[model samples]
Target: MDYDVFDLGDVRLQSGITLPDAKLAYKTYGRLNAGKSNAIVYPTWYSGQHYDNEWLIGEGMALDPSTYFIIIPNMLGNGLSSSPSTTPPPHDRARFPHVTMYDNVQMQHRLVTERFGVERLELVTGWSMGAGQTYQWAVSHPDMVRRILPFCGSAKTSLHNIVFLEGVKGALTADAAWDNGWYREQPGVGLRALARVYAGWGFSQQFYRERIYEREPLGYGSLEDFLVGFWEGLFIKRDADNLLAMLWTWQNADVGRTPGFDGVAEALAAIRAPAIVMPAEQDLYFPPEDSEWEVAHMPDAELRVIPGAWGHFAGGGLNPVDTKFIDDALKELLAKDV
Candidate 1:
């Protein structure tokens, strides 16, 4: 209710199924200038809503709402949008049609152009699955987006990454209460199991080695406390079906799969925008090496590895140092002439 919903009205997805009465939830910061060129599109990550993206937007930060109009579009299965929990009848719960990263960006394009009258984007950036959409935007409409900064994410989901997601998905579906995603009650057991699986991959070995969770801000007494309080607590609040829906989107993400491109390199080469690809040094899922390959294919791009042991969460805005590092990068990128 805090965000505005754009009626998509029966959107046909890439899976060849029509989602009846589809809606896209989004929140905006600042005002669109007269020229409409001061816009920045910052899409949501997996299971994240518009508010979850606010950490990057502030008065002095690169995403400063006072300076630029920042748009945070919620992904389809993120609950706020037309997700399984919000949808009704046939397309509800486990029956929701599969949505791809391509499908997500296409709808976002409608919200930006048809709704806001924005033709050219000053920047398109995000983390995790949001980063996947960033790549999609730059490739799908290279002429519209001026610059991009994708952090802790990839242009294409790696084979290893897909395998990792399989484990997460398996854990959730394994619970009896899941009932093929149609359970009347929330699948608490499955969600907790999924959280446990995710805990192993979300951060680096070094993070656990140093027992950083015991420190301030996190302040957990022990490993079990951190796992139960932080990891389990995060996933338990989310709907199991919604998580599964977004997981499908993440697992199948690839710019190379776009209609015109034969492969990832070809799609990346098509992006004409200036890009700064950032990957965490200790990220288990999205390693710096993968980001290096993406930058190599991009026409104009450079890799900036975020040095930290927070792993993928380094870009998740938990650590102030990492957050500042990311903000500084965006500041430098936005200052560029291109």
Candidate 2:
């Protein structure tokens, strides 16, 4: 609700589908310098909004507002943005067209350039799906960005990632109440099932072995208790159709197919911004090896595995140890000469 909307009428998607009334929801922190060279764009991750992104931002932190003009743009298909749940007829629910991470970065490009008159960016960084957008920005407009830090994500979606996402999509579509995304109400049954699927994959095996779910902030008595009280409760509040749209975008993420690349190697070769590819060691969805492979191909990129048992959720900054690691990495990245 604290964000502003920028309407880009009838935006054309990469698939050649036109999305009418296309808009972007974004929040800005700190004042822009006269030169606007201190700007940083942070795109949201899947099912994440600006609020979730601000946890890692504060005085002297990774995204310190005092020295940087940070812009957090909600990714398309998120409920707060121009998503299936919020868009009007002809493109409502499952009727939304295919959109890629490339499209999302283009919109962010518009928000900063046209709205703020910022031609160059100091940094572009994010986590997970947000990181996907960061990757796209670096490859799509290399000259505009000086640095990029993508955590727990990749420049392209791997075969292993797509298979995991298929399970989630299948679970949601399987419920009778889903009605192919035209449900009269939110599909509670399917959403609950989808939550269960996420619960299984969101954390590491060590997490369960140590019973971390019963720790502070969330003290569920049993596995069922955590599933219903935490997982199910969290996802059922989200729009099912919008979730599907984000999933599709995430599954099909690839910079190789975007304008300039003949192949994945070509895409990696196109990057000019210095990048830090941080992958969580225990993440099954975006394994460190996947990021390692992409880093090997890029001209100016390095791999830094997040050592922890939090899996994909390690980037959330929920645990102190994980938070400190992120802060340290970001501080080091920002201090480097551009």
lDDT of 1 by residue, 1-338 (tens): 68899999989998899999999999999999999989999999988888888999999999998889999999999999999999999999999999999999999999999999999999999999989999999999999999999999999999999999999999999999999988999989999999999999999999999999999768999999999999999899999999999999999999998888899999999999999999999999999999999999999998999998999999898889999999999999999999
- Candidate 2 displacement at residue 271 in angstroms: 0.8
TM-score each candidate: 0.99, 0.97
Q: What is candidate 2's TM-score against the reference?
A: 0.97
Candidate 2 segments exceeding 4 Å error: none
Please report how far candidate 1 places residue 61 from its true position, in Å: 0.5
Candidate 1: lDDT over CA atoms? 0.95
- Candidate 1: RMSD over Cα atoms? 0.8
Candidate 2 colliding pairs:
none
Window of ten residues with lowest summed lDDT in model 1: 210-219
Query: Model 1 compared with the native: what TM-score?
Result: 0.99
